[model samples]
Target: MNFELFIARGILSKDKNNFSRPIVRISIISISLGLAVMILSLAITTGFKDAISQKVIGFGSHIKITSFDLNKSFESSPVDMQQPFYPSLADSTGIRHIQVFATKSGLVKSEDQIQGIVMKGIWSDFDRSFFAKNIVEGDLITIDPEKRTNDILISKRIADKLEFNL
Candidate 1:
């Protein structure tokens, strides 16, 4: 037998009760635990990234077309839906669909408290599938082309703070 093989066999023999035996067992266990932890961390990080990405895309679409103004605020400048590019965007390659939306920053006042909020306005053509999966309590709002409605949807956090519910 080779010198390395002979030495390795002597070190790993079951009859030996030397310091190296405990050290070898501990090293194997430590390596196994480290690998397990790494795998778990990777899985958790991937799931967290996917969840956060879905929430962000749910709040706003993948792409937004707005006026090229220099205004620095959460509210975006309005874009005309009658633009020539608006229709072509839906038919373009790698594009799934197009939607028109608007946002306005405002304040909501309760009997004893006032809170700032940004209101997002969507039309009938806006896709509600993303939100349908996330509605915690009530149904989605219905918009009529011939009439205006006073219905609004609020998050649970905001509802608790403003003392509002369905």
Candidate 2:
């Protein structure tokens, strides 16, 4: 039977003194609960995905430009920091800034903890306003040439894994 006809029958069954009111109440409750669960799942999934992706995008520039040849080897190579145009390509492109990056894959060693990770070294001119906005503790990592220490800013997930308070 069609859905509308089925519903009419259900209503008329009760009106005609059939003993199915309790069953109809249960069906209504089950349908409401199912819809509630589906809505809750969609809301949580959308919110969680948006929050996580925004953090990732904020930590890194929206796009990057590099010589395809230089990036092929996946090794660490420092930029000269003397030239202006190469690093300022993003500025010219109407973007905020262009940051040079070198990636190093290695194991991080602490007194009581160790972890494997890839560190992306950003150039001195790379504006860190994006990171500063998302930092949870300590301080944002500044790329000053004179103060190049071994300290690095890590994500909250890494901090949790390492048992660091940041």
For TM-score, the strongest prediction is 1
Regions of candidate 1 where Cα sits further than 4 Å from its true position: 1-17
- Each model's lDDT comes to 0.86, 0.74
Name the 10 consecutive residues with the lowest summed lDDT in model 2.
65-74
Candidate 1 TM-score to native: 0.87
Strongest candidate by lDDT = 1
- Assess candidate 1 and give its lDDT: 0.86
Error of 2 at 136 (Å): 2.9
How do the residues 1-166 of candidate 1 rate in per-residue lDDT, one tens digit apiece? Answer: 9998898788878888887888877887999999999999999999999999999988887888788888989797778779877777888899876877889999988898788999988888878888899989899999887898877888888888998766
- The number of clashing residue pairs in model 1 is 0
Over 1-166, each residue of candidate 2 has an lDDT whose tens digit, in order, gives: 8999997686857456656777777898999999999999999999999988887777665775444454554564454656666645645756765567877777776678898878788767767777778778898765678776677887777788788884
| Model 1 / residue 12 / CA error / Å | 3.4
